[model samples]
Target: MATKTPKNPQKKHDGRRKNLIDNKNLKSPRTGIRKWVYRFFVAIIWFLILLVPVTIYYAHDLPDISEITQPKGGSTVMVMDRSGGLLASYGDVYGDWLEFDDIPAVLVQAVIATEDRRFFDHGGFDIRGFMRAMIKNITTGRMVEGGSTISQQLAKNLFLSADKTLKRKIQELLFSAWLEMNFSKEEILTYYFNRVYFGSGAYGIDAAARIFFGHNARELSLIEAAMLAGVLKGPALYSPLRDLERSYRRMGDVLDNMVEAGFIQKSVAEKTKAENVQIVDKQTGGDERYFSDWIVERAASLIGRVNEPVIIYTTLMPDIQDKANKALQRIMDQEALTHKASQAALVSLDMDGGVRAMVGGTDYTVSQYNRAAQAQRQPGSAFKLFIYLAAFERGLSPDDVMRDSPVILKGWQPKNYSGEYLGQVTLREAFVRSLNTVAVKLAERINRKNVIEMARRLGLTTPIVAE
Candidate 1:
């Protein structure tokens, strides 16, 4: 039996190899799983290693939370007329800072309903909302909905720019999380109301209320609150001042949202939508915006860098401004087709150099160029006044005689506007007739530099070349 059981060496080696193959097959599933697990852990560690620097880079330029009350740029510049009427506002206009408790409940509800319904429950980032918006945007093939929560919006307003970049979006998310960790929900809502920009340069709920309804935020009606909330989506697009009908339609949408969010009854929302909401008359500053704009710049120059809110009083008269606007509009409307003129500017000043009214162009909405202040043109006959004034200061009377004949200077021939010169006319007559030749001769006689000096003494800030 021992002799017969002596196996071949090759057969024994094959049997050993077969056993090794059997063991490998038995452990194949677990070994494969283990190899995958090891790769996943390595990838995870590398991701974590990369995540730290990326997060730091995004969070580096975030605004200091300590300066939450202060805006990013300069504070508002409220320009008032001499009679204490609001002419226009430049920059962000914030009202009295109201606490969370002081905010109107309906306004808060409206904002929550329209902006972020899950605002109270979210951890700064609403994954549900984000998913919904993403799905909706994907299905619709257009960005009709935004996923940013109230905290995210606040973060953007306070810290980030409006650029739609991956970095900005990531930073916004991080800042929103930071805000959520640092402040309460009520505090976030309060900051949102106070810092979020509304239309018409208004920066807070109170400012929005005053600008849109001519009242305080506490006095906001249901529909008014809904409208204000609606304006948040697109300030310039949905502004009641810019388009009341579009604004009302947006308000309806907000009211429907409020009803859907269970903030108000459907019937109540319907009634509010049906009822006419009282909004302040759209005060675009009309043509007076030119003067307001000019005065704001002037005030800024005089006051230097404005950090806090500043009230600037000016000599603009509302009534005169209206008249100027109407007159220019009428003239442009009636004669634009005939005269081939599309724009005109007017500036009326008081005797003491106070700008009472200004029409920058045919329409401020159309063209903001202030031809009265910004444009440079030949003085033409307007310069004759300075010439006569210079002569008068040199002891020449207004009634003194001057030759009104055609004259040439440097190959340039001066002619009267009427193409007929009355020879040997009195100074007053020459000025009344606007005789260019006589005015030119007077400037040459009195010295052109003296005329420039006279103009400078009279508050002419424009450069004067005596050529």
Candidate 2:
């Protein structure tokens, strides 16, 4: 056994060489796997490169088409009446719904100059704008404002969700490009006029026109138009109805912008501001806060939430909302004075089911609990709205007869409210009186379930339990 080892010393080298050759053969397959991995990564990088610019283009360029559909209720021209008292004070509602024609050229010029001078030139994403903005920001040592075009802002409002992420930016760019290709500049401007919010639940230029100047978009003078245009810079701060000083300052800026953009001469801007403005007092602007609240809630259904920055255009009657507000406030004041634990609510709904007004409480500062829209209460005799409406819907005319007498109802004897029993009375009289016994008798006669269903169909969200 010991003598056999010396003959195969070279054989040992031969076996080692064979092992190295086998390892080299396996390395080729490994190299192929590495190549495939590299190709996959390269494809993803290319996609991101193409996607970022395109996505940004679309999200920043397109108009929100969904908002242009006449909102929930009311027409555009309901705001033409304003003298002595508001149109809404006597139950006449005023709301403006502006399209392109309602806007002033001066207002448009001012916005274009102040916000994005190159808005007409850029294809959604403006490289020159980006570069200039970057340079300016770098030199200033902070980001003052983004050079986002109106189209981009519109795109963000319409399609792109306001999430600060690279993916969203890509979507925005892509959509912007498509928008620029599909829509004309005038079309884009039209959508922008109707979709942008102007504080106080004013969705479009039309709504803003009615609220601020007591007129339609068609009636805005140069100065009145400038005031509205100024609001675009800061709605809550420069709302002409809220802060006159801030509004005047913003109007001046708008005038300056118009002058710079060559839409107006310097003298014209000065003349417009001095002679044309008619600022209404904030206190007398009328109260449509309840209507605003209604729109805010419904707008969440349209976009996502009010906080999401999704654009909303609604057809709420400003006058009706104001009326509801005053009436509700009056009732709440009376209730509070009479009872310490009392809180009142009022709601005004249009024929089309658009909630015109919904006041939850008198004290918004004390609590934001919306009593009208959110609270569930035992409404007492006020609950008769369901019974009366139910009867009317069933073809029961006001002249229809329903016997009103003491009726023993399921261990609970329902009686006349005043303890005076009329031998026979019309259901109308009983409803007007809000008699509990008549309602109970009718509940016994008609399908209680059907009446309940009717109440529900009529937009009563409260739970109806038959006793």
> Number of the top candidate by TM-score?
1
Give each model's clash number.
0, 23
Off by over 4 Å in 1: 1-27, 30-46, 69-91, 287-467
lDDT tens digits by residue: candidate 2, 1-467: 45555678899999987788689555434367788998899999999999777655645644454553445332221122222222322111335555566667766777787677788888888887778878899899777446677777777656666677776666666666666787887777877777776755576777778767766777777777777877876564577654566788888887787788788899987777677466443443233443444445454444442322233344555576567768877766677666774666777666776565566666554433456765667777866777677767777778878777788856888676698777678887888887788887776666687678877886777556764
- RMSD of every candidate to native, in Å, equals 18.1, 17.0
Give the Cα lDDT of each candidate: 0.83, 0.66
TM-score of every model versus the real structure: 0.56, 0.45
Score candidate 1 by lDDT: 0.83
| Model 2 TM-score, all chains together | 0.45
lDDT of 1 at 141: 78
